[model samples]
Target chain A: MNDPVAFVSAMKAIGAGLAMVSAIGAGIGVGIAALGGVQAMGRNPDAAPLIQTNMILGMAFAEAVAIYALAVALIIIFAA
Target chain B: MSEVETKKRRFGFKRWIVLALIALGVYTAFLGPTIFRPISPVVVLPPEGTGLEIFGFPITNTILGTLIADLVVILLGLSAYRFHKSGQIVPSGVYNFFEVIVQFLWNTVEGAAGNKWGKRIFPVVATIFLLIFVANLSKLIPGYESFGQIKELHHGVGYAPVKLFTIGSLNVYTIDKGQPVEAGHADEEHAASDDKSAAYSVAAYAEGGDELCHSCEVVPFLRGAATDLNFPLALAISTVFLVQVFGVWALGPAYFEKFFQIRALVRGGILGSVNFVVGLLELILEFAKVLSFSFRLFGNIFAGTLLLSILGALTAVLIPVGLYFFEIFFGIIQAYVFFLLATMFISIALVSHHAEEHH
Candidate 1:
């Protein structure tokens, strides 16, 4: 516990773990987006391609949040 | 009915093959010799130096990957150009394959951004998709991040190398389950530096200790290009810069109006002030776009590589096969996502603020 290097490394590990917690929000956002897209496709199956395209685009945007969190976690573990 | 029966028979045959393979995997995993267990790779964040230099510039493995990816893109382009020059009315073989991809991409671009702007943006978007897709998929090739120059590990812990064989002067080696070198043993070997036979002996490996070895490790010749931040960041910067260029080209000088709403502020009303603030936020969001674009691609590809390596180390056979397919799927998805975002941003930029307000 007295070793500063060990203490700092432990803190970084904890911080990296905490950063990934932000992925929960992105998970929910992506799920909701998928739900809406699937429902829209069910309602109008003829527009499936358009709906699918938009659905992927929305999921990418939502996933970007989790990607950001991952970046933060990696920076904490490696860069910092 | 005959066709259906044939299809069912083929399916059953494939199922048997799969089951036999899985059974073999189970046997190898549980009942195989200790040597069959793969050495867990030492994971490093930054790309390792291959000890090669170009005019004093040290070459990293990721750079090698980037060059390979570039070569693939160039060769494909050349092939496509040759196919076009041949003037085949009905394309076939490799040309047909290229045609399908190009046609699909063209339709997607044209659908997202109407015919006019889509034509202008298609080249850049398609190039991004092709380059990224190739770069990401290249990681799955055998021997990537595997075969490399063996360098003595000076600082960090490394696995004991098992000598595979010797050809002429070269002694080829692969790692075994990591056995740490004891401090006393290491020092004794260092003292007897002149005796080459005293170094890296089988007896040392046989007498394993709790202590870790700062021994030799392999620095792979090639790593996934997107796993490196430099490649992704460079691509993101160029993509964002092109987005701005497209905006300026479309809207003329008025494109600047999106970022700085001085006219709105000059109106001196509460709503006008809100509009001006929103424009400032838009400017910040443009910069944020660069970060998001780079990190999204980098994080996904890097995480995929890490997952693959860890899974491969844990179970050397059947499990990683599924993950390889998953990585391939993700490679395509990430490439398409990047392309789609770039196209969408360009299309958004093409529209005038006044037109949006009217809508």
Candidate 2:
């Protein structure tokens, strides 16, 4: 038969790319979150630091979703 | 007003000003760790471990890093002390730098421990924090995680090989050049020394890779400390035991009455069987304290380390930089949580039994 290695490698590439699609949610979510935080900072400059700290915390929490997605994708691509 | 009252007012006013300054310091630290709190790595191990070691243990760059970091911090502290004597105006530069860390850790420990006991634990917690925090943050530096090797080792070399698992623990032979070239060892000199051939055949972790981080590839470092699971587990066991120890210390032999509910039995006399049973349940819960302390710290930090690895495998860009902020927050929280719970455990141990003490 033709090289199965070529086929498996192609599947992983596709899977890795697809797995990274999970970042879209994170990207959109983080962008919107940043916009919200920036707006709040504009309204209250004093509150900006606390708000930003919380924002990063929120973003980290949100980023965990992307991490979860990446993990799923990684398991697909890397694991036998 | 009396002289004492006037003096008290002055002191209180100064205290408030100091508090504001501290508030500013903390705010800056949270928003911008770069300005104030950047940690560096330490190298512990030396270079002579042949591609494969004559001894059973594996030696790597992290070992070297840990030792160097320890040496620098300890030596720097000693040097700072000698340079700045008892109450000249103030110390500057690295002396000032260390003074700030001392202050930060002092507050962190005291905040967690409360005034009395906090002072005692401050040095231990603060030292560990300074060391680990510096070590952790240093991982961000260009060469910190990048010094490790990527070698394809001969998996099964004959002599005295274990029979069981084919995959050796030292599967990836990292010629770990863990330390930066010392002041004494010039770069050219290092390169020249075939004698101290630090096998630093390192691998570059590209943007977006695999399960673990290329830098921290969860395989295991040569120098594992109490921060490791075994250490943490021992900490957990001791802490939980310490809780009981302190509890007994605070309450005396009667503290066991907490477990037995002899007080409740005495009050209820014949009809206290249900309450007695409930007391036994509380005893069981105390045992779970060990599990809580161990797993909570291990899980969070271990996961934090894992997450960073994955992040490295992903985009090596502005994104991972953001996660550095997240890791700082996560690191502080985990450290504080460990300290706080330990404090609470100790507090529980230390607290005097109101009813019995009065009686």
Candidate 3:
């Protein structure tokens, strides 16, 4: 922390690492969504296409949080 | 009055066995040794394209890639038009494929933009989708980026040798009679052996002490267009600009009211002030949409390119095939998202406040 350049570099690295922690949340969220989708599919096979589309859309949105985290990490590493 | 519960579907025993076999196969594939030596893949920003200068303007590999995509699109369009004009009722080959794509895109846009505006915006949205889709998928073609010209390094030009996939020392070159000459020729009994001022140049791309005297660098001729920020930014700006123009054409002078809210301020009350501020905020949000739109597509596509290049550098074998498939899917989804977002913006603009209240 005494050296400004070193401190900033360390902090940036820490920030990038912290940003990736959101991936854990995103993973859990997607897994829960997929579980629900699977249960729905099991219960109503006829509504498979509609359910699958919605499920994938939801998963994409959820995964977007992870992508955001990755973008942040990239910016921190490169832009910093 | 009753919940008519459908019976739960279960996978058959044969299906379970197939799934298990596939899982095992994938696991074993991962367990196998890597095809190439493990190296920390370097990720560079603002992707380095071959700086090919044409009349003082440097054209990038990404631009070349875009040009290739545009050419492909145009050629296909011309062929499709010919096929249509021939009036073959039993559509086959390119005609059938073109019809299917166009019909699908039209239906999708029509659903989102409604029947009236859909016809107006279909060309713009479909063109963007097709161009991006082709550009994205074009990267997967073999030798699309891997083949290029090898440039020889000259002395006094600050060329730092970076690591390449190959493992060999570069051949050293020396100035012989004012020309770069390879040093290994013992048969040349030139009297220059006594000259200490002769400059020796060597190029090597790794951190090994065994450096080659003369090194050449490969400049890839093609790169994914979306991997560059310029393409996405230009697309986003044009899309948003077009949306605004369409809005003005549709709503006339009333369209500016969404941003300025002069009418709201003139009819002043506490709510009118809030509305005016909200209008300003909404205007700023529109610009933010441009940034978000460009960055989202640019980030996803660039990241995919980075991933593929890194994977390709790491292993020369079967590992990257799965990645290629995933990238293809991701590219298609991004194109769809971009198309949908543009349509949504236009539709949102088309729906004025007065029109909604009249309903």
Model 1 alpha-carbon miss at residue B119, Å: 2.0
Task: Say which docking band candidate 3 falls in.
Answer: incorrect
In the range A8-70, model 1's lDDT, one tens digit per residue, is: 999999999999998999999999999999999999999997998889888878888888888
Model 3 Cα lDDT, one tens digit per residue, A1-80: 67998888898999999998998998998898899999999999998755765676666567667766877887898786
lDDT of 2 by residue, B1-359 (tens): 69999999999999999778766655543443332321222221122231343366754444444555566578667856776656556777777878876776566446545788776555545555555544444444554443333322222111111112124333332222232223223334435763554432222123112111112211222332322444345666766777777677667887777678777677775557667777788788676665555544444554555565455434333455677788777666655445545655565556655474468
For residues B1-359, write the lDDT of model 1, one tens digit per residue: 99999999999999999998877766655566543465556677787887779999988999999989889888878778888898867777776776787788899999988998889999999989988988999988988988886555655555566667666545666655546544355555656773774455434433331122346567788999998898888889999999899999999999989989898889889988999999999998888788889999998898898889888878877889999999999998899889888888888898898668658
Steric clash pairs (candidate 3): B162-B205, B163-B205, B170-B212, B171-B214, B172-B213, B172-B214, B202-B213
Q: Which ten residues in a row have the lowest lDDT in candidate 1 chain B?
A: B205-214
Write out the backbone clash pairs for model 1: none
Per-candidate DockQ values are 0.78, 0.05, 0.15
Error of 3 at A23 (Å): 5.9
**Which regions of candidate 3 fall more than 4 Å away from where they truly are?**
A1-10, A19-73, B1-41, B149-218, B357-359
Model 1's TM-score against the true structure: 0.87
lDDT at position B235, candidate 1: 86
